[model samples]
Target: MDAYYNCLGCMNRQVRVLTMDGQQHEGTIVKVDRNNVYLKKESNGRVQTSAFYPGYGYGNQILTLSLFTLLAIALI
Candidate 1:
């Protein structure tokens, strides 16, 4: 099965991804291409505030995972 094609159908949707290294990431799919899948990672309810700038919410983070490294991608 082509991981890229599978991920293409999941764009802009929340999903849980498991990589070949056994790491799990839950996020909203931001982009999918031939080589990678970009995810807007969900925060675990812990606000990430920078010390340099107080009271600033960094917001959700984006992660880039290789398409070949993805072991599983499930809709949440």
Candidate 2:
């Protein structure tokens, strides 16, 4: 979980997340754990309820990114 901590230090900051699959996501790191990294995207907010909003689209959203798939994370 050392690498997870590395990204853990980035909590609340905008970051670019790269995964092993070549997929990337840019958002603010909200929370992190041993298994996953949670994020609140710039386009999303608390006003938009997660119930109505889809998984990764605009509105209140929390992206649960699996740490196992993470390749690199960079503060933006």
Candidate 3:
């Protein structure tokens, strides 16, 4: 619940998420619910590789990160 409150304090902003696995994700949060945070991953990295399919994963991917897996989150 505290995490949800902390998240609400910074809604609709670009955040850099650091996971427990050491992966870093930068994206604008689209939604945050009870168990997960959904984000639209930035496309800048993929735009340089392929204009037609710039996103690294699939089309317009959204991240559903479990709060338990996150190590840190910062506004970028």
User: Which candidate leads in TM-score?
Assistant: 1
Instruction: Assess the local accuracy of residue 30 in candidate 2 as a C-alpha lDDT between 0 and 100.
Output: 74
Better of 1 and 3 by TM-score: 1
Worst lDDT run of 10 residues, candidate 3, spans 47-56
Can you rank all candidates by lDDT, best first? 1, 2, 3
lDDT of 2 at 3: 61
Clashing pairs in 2: none
1-76, model 2: which lDDT tens digit per residue?
8668977899889999898999888887777889888877655533321223244555556777889899999998
Model 1: residue 31 alpha-carbon error in angstroms:
0.5
In candidate 1, which residue pairs get closer than 3 Å at backbone N, Cα or C atoms, i.e. clash? none
Question: TM-score of every model?
Answer: 0.76, 0.74, 0.71
Residue 45 lDDT in model 1? 65
**Candidate 1 displacement at residue 69 in angstroms:** 0.2
Tens digit per residue, CA lDDT, model 3, 1-75: 766665666678988888899988887766677887776676657521112222435565676777777788889
Task: Kindly provide the TM-score of model 3 when superposed on the true structure, using C-alpha atoms.
Answer: 0.71
Q: Write the residue-wise lDDT of candidate 1 on 2-74 in tens digits.
A: 8998899999999999999998988777777788887777467642221222232355445778899999999
**Model 1 segments more than 4 A misplaced:** 46-60
CA lDDT for candidate 1 = 0.76
